[model samples]
Target: MKGNKGLIFLSLMPWLCMEADAAQHWADTSAGVRWSSSFREPYNPEKVSKTILNVTHVSQDDYGRNFLFMDYYISGMEDPSKDNATGAEEFYGLYRRTLSYNALAKDPIDSSWVKDVHLSGRMDVGYENTQLSPRPFKVRMGGLVDFKIPKGSLEWGLEGVYQKSYNGITHRHFEFDPSFVTWMSWNYPVTKKSQFSGILEYLEAIGEDGFGNDTKPLTIFRANYIYDIGQPKGFKVGVGYEQFNNKYSSNNAADPTNGSDQKTFVLLGSYHF
Candidate 1:
C-alpha cells in the first residue's frame, strides 16, 4: 500500500477538481493530543466503554491541507462488550488539494453559495479485535465543496471508497470496489476565541459479515464546541459528542439490517507548536 500511490491517485479521477492558488510550499503545521470516553465503532455490537488517548497532527501547504490522528485504547480489557479491544491502535488521515471556486465556474456567480472546492484523499488503518473494524485499511478520494455563510463555512464532499476484506490477502490490496462515502461539515465563529463545528457522514460498506452477509449504510455524527485558551490561540479545549446510527458490520441486536446505535462523550485538548 505504501508504494501504490499512483493507483490511489488514479482512483481519484472522478472526484478530482481544480487546484488551489497559493505559494508552492508548506504553510502551517501543528500537533496535539486528546482523550475520549465510551467510544463506539462500526464493528462493535455495543459501546466500548473505555478511555483512549489520541495524538494528532495538522499541516497545510500550497497544494492542500492534511490531517493525521493516532488513537490508542486504554481501559477496554475488563469490558467484554467493548468493540475497542485493550491496546488497540487506529490511524486515519486526510489530504486535500484546494480548488478555486471562481476558476471552476468562470461565470462569476453569487459568492454566497459557493466559496471553494478541493480534490481530497483520505485513508484509515486500524488494528482489529472481535469488537471493532476487521479491515486494516480503507482509502477514499473525492472533491469537497465549501459554502460561505455569515460568520462561518459549510463543506460537503463525496468520495469513492476502496476497501479490502479482512481476510482478502496477506496485505490489504486495491479492492477498487466502488463503495460510497460522503460528508457534510460546518464551522462557525462564536466569539473572538471560540467556535462551533460539526460533521456528518454517510458510509456505505462492501464487506461481508458472519454467514457471508452484507451490512447496511451507516450515519456518523460528531460535533464540538472549542475555545482558544491563551494568547495567539496556542492551546485549545473542546467538549464534543459523537454518534453512529449503525455500525459497518451486521451485528445489531434489535435489527441486524440497521446495525446498532452507538454514542460517546469526548473531552479533548490540543496545542500548536
Candidate 2:
C-alpha cells in the first residue's frame, strides 16, 4: 500500500469537492494512545501486548458528514527494522462520507422516530509487515439510516464491497471476492461531562483468501465510556472494551488455540481540537 501512493491520491479525489461546495458545520481532530494485551494476528498463537497510536477526525457539513481515522501499531523489539533495529509497524486508515437525503431532497422523509437517511461510502486501506504481509484495500457503497431515540440516536448502515489484496512477499494480487458489511452505532449521555458510546460492525464471508484458507464472517464490537476532563479545551479520557472474532477473515474451524478471537480492555486518552 505504501508503494501505491498515486492510488491513494486518486481515491481521495471525491472528498476535495467538500471544500468548495459545502458549508462547514463542526469539525474535530483527536489523538490518542491505546494499549491492550490481548491483541492477535492471524495464525499467531501468542497474544501480544499492542500499543496503538490513533488519530481521528470527524466533521459535518450542511450537505453531509465525514469521518477519517488512522491507526499505527508500534513495536518495541528489534524484529523487522534492520537499520534502526526497531520492531515491525503496521498501519490502517479509513475514511467515510455520507450524503444526506434529507438535505438534498425537496421532500424529505420524516416521521416521529425516523430522523434522516444518507447515501454512504467508505474506503479502507491497511498494510502489515508481519508474516502474511497483507496489503488490503476496499471500497464500500451503502446507505445509512439515523433513527431518533429518547436522549440519543441509533445509526444503521449496510454496504457491499469487493476485497482486494496485494501480497508484499509474493508481489502478487489475491483473489477478488465480494462481501457485505453492516454496522450499528449509538451514543448516550451518561452525564453532562461523560457519555457512553459504541459500535458493532460485521463483515460477511467472501470465500477463500489468498492463502487458500476458507474465510468466515468477521465481527468487531467496541464500547467506550468517556469523560471530558478538559471541557474548555476538548480534552478527553476514556476506557474501552473490544471484542473481535474471526479476525482478518481467518477460518473459525481452525484451532481455537490460535489467537483468532480476542477480547480485551483498552486504555485511552485523547485531545480534541
Candidate 3:
C-alpha cells in the first residue's frame, strides 16, 4: 500500500533530523549533505536521482527573523519491491517579524527605497510513499519585501505566500479557494568569493484533491553558483539548477497532475555555524 507507507516514512529520516536538532537549540546553525547524480544526462525518476540531507537554522535578534530546515531524500534507485519512494522527506519553517528592520535602518537615510520589511510565516510538511499523492501539508501566511540593491553583492527578496493545504490518502482535490504563492530570491556577486543564488516561484493550486484530481498552473525554478571556502565559520560550494512545470502532478501515473516538465542538476556543499 503506497510502498508500505513510503517504507515507514523513510525510516524516520534520521530520527526526524535529530528531533529537529533537539528542538532548535543550537541557535544559528547549518549542517549539510548533498550528493546528486545525472552525469551525461539520461537520468530520470520524474526528474531527480537524488541524495540529500540538510539541516539549517538561522536567527536574528529582536524576534524578527528565523528559519529552519530539514530535508532528506534518498532514492537514486531504491527498489524495496517497487513503487520508487514513499514520503522522501521535506520539512520546513519560516518566521519573520522585523517590524521594519529597525525602522528602515533608523530614519530613511536617503530613501533608496525600503530595504527591509517583514511579517512572514510558513510551515511545510511532506512525506511520501506514493500511489499518486502520498502526503502533503502546507501553511503559509506571508508578506516580506526587501529592496535597495546598489552595486554588486546583492541579496534581493520578495514573497507573498498564502497557501493552506493538507491532503493524503491519495487525494484528488476539490477544496477550492486558498492558494497563492509568489516568490523571488537572489544572491548575486560573481566575484569576491563568488556568488549566484536563486529561487523563483509562482503557484496557485486550482483546487481538486479528493479524487476529483486537478492541478495545472505551476512554475518553479532555481539556480546556483556558490564559491567561498574561506572558513572561519563559513564554507560553500555549489552548482545547481532546477526546474519544474506542472500541468498537474499526483505522481503522473497517467494523469495524476499532468506533468509539464522537470529538470535537475546539482553538486553543492555547505558548512555554516
For 110-161, candidate 2 gives per-residue lDDT tens digits of 7987889988878889987765567888888788999978887689999987
lDDT sort, best first: 2, 1, 3
**Model 1 clash number:** 0
Ranking by TM-score: 2, 1, 3
lDDT string, candidate 3, 77-143, tens digits: 4311125444233334433322345433555334577566665555565554433333444545556
lDDT of 1 by residue, 1-273 (tens): 555657876755533432233443443344555555466544344445555556566545444555566765554543342343354444444444444445455664466577667767777776544443345566777788877777787889998877654532233332434688989999888998988899999987666543355666778898999888995338888888888876654445546433267676788676755
Off by over 4 Å in 2: 1-20, 76-85
Q: Clashes in each model (backbone N, CA, C under 3 Å)?
A: 0, 0, 20
RMSD of 3: 18.1
Q: Pick the candidate with the highest TM-score.
A: 2
Where is the poorest 10-residue window by lDDT in model 1? 167-176
